[model samples]
Target: MVVGELGSGRAGSTESPPPDSAAAVLAGLDEQQRTAAAAVTGPVCILAGAGTGKTRTITHRIAYGVHTGVYTPEQVLAVTFTARAAGELRGRLSALGVGGVQARTFHAAAMRQLRYFAPRVLGGPMPELVENKLRVVAGAATRNRLTTDRASLRDLASEIEWAKTTLATPEDYPARAKAAARETPFEPAAVAAVYASYEQAKSRDGSLDFEDLLLVTAYALEEHRDVAREVRGQYRHFVVDEYQDVNPLQQRLLDAWLGGRAELCVVGDPNQTIYSFTGADPDHLLGFADRYPDAEVVKLERDYRSTPEVVGLANRIIGMAPRRRGLPGLRLLGQRAGGPEPRFLEHPDEPTEAAAVAAACRALVDGGLPAAEIAVLFRINAQSQVYESALADAGVPYVLKGGERFFERPEVREAVLLLRGAAAGRDDGALVPTVRDVLASVGWVEHRPPPGGAARDRWQSLSALVDLAVDLVAEQPTLDLAGFVTHLAERANAQHAPTVQGVTLASMHAAKGLEWDAVFVVGLVDGVLPIAQSLNRPDAVEEERRLLYVAVTRAREQLTLSWSLSRQPGGRRSRPRSRFLTGIAPESTAARRTPAARAAVVLDGAAGQLFEALRSWRTEAATAASVPAYVVLGDATLQAIAETRPRTLTELAALPGIGARKLAAYGEDVLATVAADT
Candidate 1:
């Protein structure tokens, strides 16, 4: 018999006494948390707010269930969104001494189920997982005589993924796309045809994409009773984290996994449901009580992550979103000490906004906050360029968290692999020659691509690789190619990249589940935050509001919500601050002009002079080298050099941005410039 099938009675009275191990797990939990932890027998819905210890509550609940003999560690299946989150859950459970709890992402859990059930049900192994569905879709479009460009191809790919994940087949795509009022750049019929062709091709190749992992598993469970029974037998208790973000297909998988048993618990905040674009339905989370009438609803409203001031701002912003049943507005009572009211800064243009944000970061760091404890978040990835330049100039080290890691880029990976092969047999004397050979083998052309295209970007990345080799050789004159390869491998395996030790720069979506001592939500203009693409749809706009809410709540202490009046200097103040900030009072906070807003662009004495000199050298070096200035020497590195006034070549090379290749190429010029100025 399923554990929760004993009828939806009140928690604990009918249950067995929990073991001694559960006492340690339940020690620090608040009344609400303790109650939720104890309600291990029935369906529980935790409306956990930001930083209210949702992870803590859920992990404890799982541990409590195991200790109380309600469920074994092997019988509990906990699913979250990301691999990082899943790993964290497993780690927490391990720390609590309850190991073997099957904590995984929805896709991971489904994939495991599919692998186990496929051979028995389908009489064959599961199809190979497709790594690049977009490429396959592009090919399919060509075969179907559907003319498409890169952007349209991407849209078509997304539509296909959305269709499949929503349980719609290719035949149903055109109708579904039209009915949903999806903003597809291509005709619905044309996209549907392309999707059809893409599906056929995937079948022909005997492979499945990421979306197929969940769709196929759900299908198997519904169609095959034995498969479903076997899965249910193995894992009986289910706990889902971030249930608000569950797309329809995942919900189907969850249902299939439960197999009519009500032994499940889900935790989410409706206000944090921001992935509607990917077909994630907040309705599932909102309608949990109705679905499982006996489900106990627990609201966790104590804000532990942010100060009272920051929490107040979050509560106010979320209140602006229209309310509905099951999705009530939660007013977080901040438990942390009071902090300064979140700042609302209005700038004349993007450059000034970026500079001010950089300056703010610098001030925070200089005032004793670690650089790693600060972040600059924006609505979109494109908005990071200006801030990246500004931060580089300010001598700040920062990591762009959401983008492709430096070593993970396709070109970089290929080059590294080639280098690894060459290093295996080569001696130190042949290292430079081996590096040159590896670049050539990997199609590295010496000449630059005509500016502003993917080709140019690839060329720059390849060029950077060459610079990397040169730097490595210089740093360790005796270190062979094998040693360098080992270093690269070690860096890749580490969770945080070597370069991620500085201030974090990330898009709002990527900044979720992460908190900082200070955060700057920049590019908050009308067209950017709600974003122009989302303007036509109300639901999309609401998701954007939630995105902003996510950004605001990421701050633990200081918060600055900023926007630029114009895109360029002396341009008209066409854009206004985001609509979400409309009812928010600007009285308590003040805007200040940064150096970028000044008419004269003053810098402090020697540092200012050094900055100018470094910029001049950078411009010349970049042009001659046919690469972006940032590639030659990031603004942050120059800023550090100017402020620190490193006296020797070694000192200059030791700065954060100056890698081995950089030190080899520009080390002499940088040291001379600094020495001459001093």
Candidate 2:
């Protein structure tokens, strides 16, 4: 079992952990980590900022609970945001000598329980899960003869998932659709019709979608008190990771599972809730204290991951977020002291930006950081391409997320579909693609060759096998495409697991809960980072900030933040750095020129305001640009000017953070402007 270690501000080696009980295990943790681990009985909210050992706390918490006998090995249920996180948590638990605990993605956990009780509760066999919702939507749309693009199909699926989670039936969907913040392509009535039809089709074909896994289970528990009691009896301790991203349906599942008997320990950074569009809410994470008034809130403020520079910048940006009217426990406190300044490099355009990022990554590694320690993050999946090309050209190893390319995986998907065909039956037109995919998967046709002859040979063999499957399917017209596809998938799944041989490339959204030694946050522009779509909604804007917060936190040691002037080289005007950077105000002397140290006199509030205006004018003249509004001059720079109102250019140059490049470029103009204003 984990033991508690009280706070001692000394860095490493300063504090010793408390002695462990039979129920608590606290090995491999420093003082603070041990404290967090031991405090598991009450609702403990670990407000772990960036670089803090959040994952460690969660893993050790589980170990402590088991060791202390607060929770039995079989009684704990741990949920993570992704399958990868779930796996990592399970490994960590085992490493701590705790095993046989329940750990899985939220969907996986719900699906397991639902299927286990299907025979007794539903009085029938378990329903098949349609792994690919996009395809299902497309086929359904085709059947309805509705002209819809892939985006529309995805929208329909999302709408259905949202409705299902909200416990809205087809009869209740129209009003909900109209009241939703974001509109879908189909009208509310038509969407309700489509949802009803989709359910009917799935029921007839014995299929279930991802949402159904949670919804069906929630309904079963709510409808049958005995089952709910049984589940609560079995899993008495509940822990959820990325708790901020929990949707309503997930909360219901947890509520039913806990049955008020289990104590809850949920760890999540509310600022990292970026899945609101998918019905996830940060409110649940933020409102934990209110949900359980007796809960003990633990603020894990020591950040062991990022340097002071990165953490400082993150805190400043977050400070701009409006505090919820009555919400407590929402604040930023920086911990680390020494590290590289969070860079804000500007490039000519995307290619140059990509090349610069790749070069910087290489430099970081050569400078002693591991390639594995570095991650290149962007706003969207599409942004991974340039980095991949630039990094590959630089002979750097990198992994690309979102798959090698969707079109390139046709063979694998086809093979799975063929197996699925057997179970789905031939009458389901949806099963046709499965058979065709199988034909393509085993080599019914020639594919565009990959670079080497070795890859070519593998593709050819797979193609030939697919051709055989197609011919066999043709011979037996009534063959079930679904079942055949499933068989093929099971056989190939193990062999075809994807791998990356180089640098890891993924969207910012995909990088959460994972950490690296060095991280490059690219494309930090106004329209991109705040994301043009998220700008208007205060909640979305907060989520965007959380996304940036997530990206910054990912950098364990070295963090590089960069942006470009335009999408295409020299096509658009030079864009400024993200406004979030302004929060840092008066960057160190190396990158900025501020005159605050030379003054023999101090300025009051009104005087400070005037001094700032004069300094801003000086900056404007030195930049050889129009002196914009007072708002453009950040609080830091303004404060610096108030502290050091330089009467001369020489004094300005002598000031901290003012570099020669800045002096020569803007010195005379700034000095003259400030002098004239005074």
The candidate that achieves the highest TM-score relative to the unseen native structure: 1
Please provide, for model 1 over 1-678, each residue's C-alpha lDDT reduced to its tens digit, 9 standing for 90 to 100.
111111122222223334567787789898878888888976888888898899999999998887777777777889988766886787678777777677778888788777877787667997799988779998999988888888888888889888987888878888887777788867887888888888899889889899988888888889998777777777889999999988888998888888889888999998898887788889998988888777788888888999999999999998888886864556688999898877776656688677666766765566578877899999888888998888776566677787677677888788778787777756455566666667878676665333433454465566655665677778777766787778667556432233333688999999988999889898887788799978988878888998999999999998878777778877776576789888884531212334332211213455557878888888999999899877897664676566556666655654556677888888988988888888
What TM-score would each prediction reach against the true structure? 0.74, 0.69
What is residue 261's positional error in candidate 1, in angstroms? 0.7
Clashes of 1: 6
Q: Among these predicted structures, which one has the highest lDDT?
A: 1
lDDT of 2 by residue, 1-678 (tens): 212200112222112224463335665666667777888785776666555678888888887877766666777778886766776777677767777677778788887788778887778878888988777767666766678888888888888888887778989889876665567777777777778878787888888888888778878888888778678777777788877788888888777677665388877766667788778867888888777777766656667767777777777777777676312543444566687666554444677667656755655554556565679999888888888877765545565655543224565555455455545555454334554454554554444534432454345444444454555467666655555554445335223233222357888888876778778899877888888876777777777887887888787667767676568744563555566666453332212323232111112334345555665565555455654433333333333334345666655544433457767865676566566656
State the C-alpha lDDT per candidate.
0.77, 0.65
lDDT score, candidate 2, position 114: 80
